[model samples]
Target: MGKWLGMCAVVAAAVLTSGAASAQSGFPSKPVHIYVPYSAGGAVDILARTLGEVVSKQWGQGVVIENRPGAGGVVASQALAGSAPDGHTLIVVASGHATNPFLYEKLPYDTFKDFTPITLLASSPNILLVKADSPFKTLADMIAQARAKPGSLAFGHAGNGTSTHLAGELLKGLAKIDINAIPYKGGVPAINDLLGGQIPMSFNNGPESVGQLQAGAVRALAVTTASRASFLPDVPSMAETVPGYDTEVWWGLLGPAGMPADLVEKLAHDFVAALNTDQMKARLTKLGASPIGSTPQQFDQKIHADYEKWGPIIKAAGMKAE
Candidate 1:
């Protein structure tokens, strides 16, 4: 009887190991939830919904995008960190994810340890926009005006410590000019105020400001990228004038930490495939975004690189949590 029991125990161990492997291999057997840590109708939300539509079509299962906007993306990030590591839940985060660690005193989730980086989907350069009839037509024009009247020129951003806010600070540091930063709960309100001439200019996502520019409501003075944006090639890059002035708003996927390695691989591959599709590329291009389908390792490196790059900037800017 002892011999028979020992054999059964060995058999059970092998069976359990096999099951574990199979479980990881057969992930996404149902719907997957991709969390967007911002309000609906924003750049992140728009990207999530677009990607979700493609993923759902490809997988033949729903890829629901849940918006959990608050706490500067901490609320959704924490919720993702707390979710089961079965690869069912993920978040589409931005540069704010990296900057939050330095901008906020304490975050509910461990930015690095609590999540598995997936592929970075796409990126868009932020544009400095002013009312269409405003006198400033170029980055040099804006800088000259601001230099002549320090702190008299005001700029607006979606929120405090957001990428737009950081862009403003980076502009200040690079140009050695002073322009007051006005914060709003969201971009639309700030855009409205910009149109009303409440503020002379603001740093905003390329897509968000595209329509306004086309409608002749706002003029894009410059793009904060190394190269000119494909959507607005006529506008010169800020780097052309400021030398090293490059800032962009990027978005990517992240699953709760400890997700099965197989699932992470599968998720990354599927997302990259979705982004590479001609339809996806055309759709994103219309929104003034470029499709970037990088590997998981690449995305991980980007997260670390951005975190290191922005940590000191946040501290130096003396940004406070809202």
Candidate 2:
């Protein structure tokens, strides 16, 4: 009986030791997957591909970027939530992620509870733009006309519940002007309409709109940032007129909710390190994205804050899922 008990004790100890050893391997036994909840060729897509390249170099493993665009990021969010929590699967979401809770009556997953915050990659302020030939040369000019006309002027956006849409809504609430807001399937269509003179103005990404503004196809009236963008230092900030008006469409990384704390720390550390590299910065700037390297906790705090702030705005605007 003593001999049998000793053998059993040895087996139990080996199993526990092996389990702990596996746990201590620090996750990511294979390639990592990053789900992008927007269409390819958009800001989120560009940002993810750039960052993924950097992360791939760092990890020496494949980092797949999967696009699951639909329902205002619901499909991607839900897909990420269902992925394994072993730090092998992640998602890069935009500002729309925060407002989805308010926009949709029912989401397939919980935004806050189902994901572990990684780090915010970067954020860029949206630029208010109009066709180059349009008479409204400045924000003041646009505001005056809209105020005078009272819902006659029109603007275009990517979709409802998106950053562009909220920017317009915030403008309405703050400026008390009545300009019409038009939604498009994506930025390409919106820019197409803006260039065709179908829409008077548009709220597009600084990086994306810079080319058009430079080519004189579209004029940038104001950037939604509180301060001037480095790329467009001459463009005045929207806050110059609308006090306390600041809105930036941001992108961030997230993993499954139960990701091991060590793996989370390592991922955040590597990502920020990659962002600090000269090559990464240059690539991001070329893509028109500003690099913002933040801690996981800071990203989480921003998510929570933005979630609280956008809830009322979405409710007041009566924004619905598109």
Candidate 3:
């Protein structure tokens, strides 16, 4: 009787240990949902969808993409902030996320307090584009015209606080020009008007403008990045014309706050692995974006840094929410 009791006790302990291990390791029992703050085909959306395909395949579960574009990502961000911290739902946001606090009077969720940083996925320069037949042939000609007639020229952007908009504001300050900033609901609508000749020029993400640029439908005046874009080698950077000018839209992944550290590590590792793949690199290269698979801490630091860096600029510009 004693021997039987001892063997039964050992079996129970083994079962308990196995159960604990399974519980601790188990994650993603359901499909993953990635929320993109921008419209479809935009850089952020593309990154989410591309990564979703690979991640879903790896996990053998569906990775759904939900596009909730509005108010410079406020809508999607609010939804994400309200979601559970199960690591199954995530939000892919752009550089605008960092500047949102300064742009808005109040946010539904605390930027850092309500979210967990996953990784910085990629970064791309915003290109200043004009209709292929516009009279402004070079960056100099465009700047000269703007300087000559302040407020006469109008440029369209995705939204008031978006990276696209900030790039324009930065240019306005550096170039000391007074071109009007027109805010659109998203990049596609802005591009629509830009192509239709309703606006003199507009800022577009690298991927958003690549097709038009390659097809000769629009002419790139200058890139917003400090350096010239590799894809548009002939086009000069705004920094070339205006010293100290630099801006690039970046995309990163984040989840609801309070996710398990182990789960966060697992998710980050898988996504970083995907980002390092040759397939992912080639796709991003074609879109004129550079892939960055940074650690969670690195991404978190970038968020804080940008939030600090742009607060002064947004406040000085007196930018208000749209």
lDDT of 3 by residue, 1-322 (tens): 1122224334333322332232336567889999998778767777888899888876788899999988788899999999999988999998888988888889899989999998777888899999999999998898899888888999999777778888898998888998999999777788889999999899988888888888888999999888787678899989899998988888889999998876777777777767767778888888888777666777898899889878888998788778
Best by lDDT: 3
Cα deviation of 181 in candidate 3 (Å)? 1.3
Compose the digit string of candidate 1's lDDT tens values, residues 1-322.
Answer: 1122224334333322332333355567889998999888877888899889988897788888899988889999999999998888989998888888887888888889999997777888888998988898788998998899888899999888888898899989989999999999777788999988899888888778888888988888888887788789899888888988888888889999998766777777677777767887887887788877666676798789888877788898788878
Per-residue accuracy of model 2 over 143-162 as CA lDDT, tens digit each: 99889899899889978888
All candidates: TM-score: 0.90, 0.90, 0.86
- Candidate scoring better on lDDT of 2 and 3: 3
Error (Å) of candidate 2 at residue 191 is 1.6
Question: Which should have the higher lDDT, number 1 or number 2?
Answer: 1
Any runs in candidate 1 off by more than 4 Å, and if so which?
1-23
Candidate closer to the true structure by TM-score (higher is better), 1 or 3: 1
Candidates sorted by TM-score, best first: 1, 2, 3
RMSD (CA, angstroms), candidate 2: 11.8
